[model samples]
Target chain A: NAGVIQTPRHKVTGKGQEATLWCEPISGHSAVFWYRQTIVQGLEFLTYFRNQAPIDDSGMPKERFSAQMPNQSHSTLKIQSTQPQDSAVYLCASTISAEQFFGPGTRLTVL
Target chain B: AQSVTQPDARVTVSEGASLQLRCKYSYSGTPYLFWYVQYQRQGLQLLLKYYSGDPVVQGVNGFEAEFSKSDSSFHLRKASVHWSDSAVYFCAASRTGGYKVVFGSGTRLLVSP
Candidate 1:
């Protein structure tokens, strides 16, 4: 399997701009997850979907952060009015069982 | 609430030395634990996982972890280390059959030759 794929390995956005990150899960995987990593905050769970449905998003910032999985293969995480605090590595993972396979992640740099 | 904790932010070891990275979890139910390794600028790679079987689970590159329900701990161990083993390690936990996962602050391992 080619494993999970994430688009735009790196992204630069000015403050107040919008940014979208994409993830393509492994074939036939039923669960997709999103996480954010920053040196100050460590790792934070943004949200997750099961069978293309959002299951949990308690970790998301709510105001400007949102995620969607419209189909089985792909999921998108969008940040509107992005801030400098949003600068971090956004990770996407896919799984059918306990273990998840992760994508290389998109490094979002907001200036 | 569920959470994971890795007390060590960074660890350094000489090549060929043994290594152990600590992890602790706070969960009410039986949780599935996992250890993942991340090379610089790379994705997280599963080093090992513990579901319901034996307490000790083996993973890639001579990596292994032991789970202790009483201690609420799942610590990773390696018999001997190499420079290639230098990476950030994360400990994660999830409720059984649950979708949400909790990750610990990664432990950065620096293996010196």
Candidate 2:
């Protein structure tokens, strides 16, 4: 298994630009999660979906951050009018049970 | 709320020396604990996990962790360190049967030769 796959290992966006990150979970996995990691804040939970349905998004920033899991295999996180503070490593993980397997992650840099 | 604390931000040890990374957790009931290792610029990899059965669990690269209910800690240990073991270690916890996971800031290990 490829575990989980995240597109655009690195991305650079100017302030006020929009960015979208993608994730492909492992086959048959029912849960997908998104997290953001920064040097100052560490890792913060962004959102999650179970069986292609959003279960929790309490950690999302609300205004510019949005996530979608339209199908079982993939999920997307979009940041509209991205700001410099949004620069961080965006991690995607998939899980069948309690243990979660993570992908390489997308490093988003907003300048 | 469930939380985890990795007190040591960084630790240095010789290649052949024994090593221990401390982790303390705060949870009301039995918690599912995990230790994950992250290589530079890479995703986090599960080192070991403790759910119920055994207090001591083994993981990849000869790593292991012991769960202590009384002390509310799950400390990772290695018999002999290797330079390859140099990485950031994270301790995480979640409510039993819950999906939300809380992670510690992480402890960086530097194994010197």
Against the true structure, whose lDDT is highest?
A: 2
Tens-place lDDT digits, model 2, residues B1-71:
67899999999999999999999999999899999999999999999999998899999999999999999
lDDT of 2 at B111: 96
Clashes of each: 0, 0
> Chain A alone, TM-score for each of the models?
0.98, 0.99
Candidate 1: residue B80 Cα off by (Å): 0.8
Q: Give candidate 1 misplaced runs (Cα > 4 Å).
A: none
Model 2: CAPRI class:
medium
TM-score of model number 2: 0.98
Best by TM-score: 2
The CAPRI-style docking tier of model 1 reads high
